[model samples]
Target: MKEKWRLLITEKNSAYRNMAMDRAELVSISKGNTPPTVRFFTWKPRAISIGYFQSLEDEVNLDACKNLGVDYVRRITGGGAVFHDKELTYSIVIPESHSQVSKNIMESYGRICGAIIKGLKQLEIDSSYIPINDIIADGKKISGNAQTRKAKTVLQHGTILMDVDVEEMFSLLLVPNEKIRDKMISDVKQRVTSIKHILGKDISFNQIADAMRIGFEEEFNIELNKGILTDEEIELTNKFEKEFFSTKEWNHRR
Candidate 1:
């Protein structure tokens, strides 16, 4: 019999709620209230999430986000700003002491990203993990991930782009001037890629989720039993959303 883990396939939500749920799962697993979990989710109305160490005003164009009706939030994990649209975002919460988890951050990243690479292969896309935390296909980035460990637990979450809009993404991010902005957008278009771009067709989210589910199971040698959030997790999610992710104090904190 294979080791069993919880799997959560959630609907689209605001940036705040998404970040909150990831943190909630981290907290729940750390407290031994829930099994280690793998969760996949998306953003509704679109959003921008900045790294924990980032300054919101420096990284995001608040006026543009407001005008475009895109939500903005700060994540507990460290990474650059990410525009969340047309992507399947995944999070895994596991004990740091789990047999498969390495204390070395780089090694841990490589192991978890192997699962993502396998998932992409199932979609017929050849991809590889770039050191630090990125997945590239055909020399262009298709996924970006970030990880944080707390209370003896590991929480890693990342985005797998289904499609990308360089122009729209640049519109919501801060850039020095029009000249620099235009050049930066051009540069990113060359660097970033997505499933639609790679496969030359649109793929449904369910299909991607299913592929990732199998990828994780195969890489970890575990059975992922589809599951729902516990009541305590739900309560924590609400608290985190209200107190941290959705608050200006948290989002604006450098």
Candidate 2:
């Protein structure tokens, strides 16, 4: 049985708003109310958000974040800390019962990466899909994804680097200030490339968003209706934004 999918465009880039959307995704998909959804979102003022199991205190510089006015939030998914610098972030929520597909994490990751690989191909980049959630080109990664499963739904999110400030990103995070970390940073540089770097020009955000939408539809061979969040989702999102995502306890909790 093929399930319908929805394409949703988010309004703003606040960490608070994105976090609310995560909760909304869980609720809607768990209830089988909303179709599987793909949402395009960005963060305002260049935020640095961590995974739910991670502690910002273990990764981010609190004083620098406060001084530079960078907001922070913890995601419901598991992964390392990510510095969201006005990058293109996408979230997909799907029910667990999708057939002829994946129950394995790596298999599911490949399915999601397929669309992204196609999208990158449009740019003549010849990107290759990598396992465990990454798209690599010329042995360098341009995209990384993470997933979390609810009772009957799964939520996966990832980032597409437009123009990552590598130095600033490494500086902001708590990397070991040792020679080994320096070598590791060099290794990372060898394995990562951004769209802006690859194209040698700036592509508008809307252009990339549109490409992703088209790519997904092409990959799945399904119709995707543009959709909106429900009122109940909005209410729960607001509560979550206030109670957890926007708080110091969450950002700093280990």
Ten-residue region with minimum lDDT total, candidate 2: 175-184
Clash pairs detected, candidate 1: none
Candidate 1: tens digits of C-alpha lDDT, residues 1-254: 99999999986988999999999999999999898899999999799999999889998999999999999999999999999999999999999999989999999999999999999999999999998899999999999999999999999999999999999999999987767998999999999999999999999999999999989999999999999999999999999999999998999888
Error of 2 at 223 (Å): 1.7
Q: What tens-digit string does per-residue lDDT give for candidate 2 at 1-254?
A: 44468888884668877988877878877887777888888888678878789877778887788788888778888887888884688888887787624888778888888877777776667787777677887778899888888877878889888878777777777775656777767777787789898889998778888888877777777667888888887887888888888887776677
Q: What is the C-alpha RMSD of each candidate to the true structure, in Å?
A: 0.8, 2.0
Give Cα distance to truth, residue 26, candidate 1, Å: 0.7
List where candidate 2 sits over 4 angstroms from the true fold: 1-4, 178-184
TM-score of candidate 2 versus the correct structure, residues matched by position: 0.92
Name the best candidate (by TM-score). 1
Worst 10 residues of 1 by lDDT: 174-183
Residue 206 displacement in candidate 1 (angstroms): 0.2
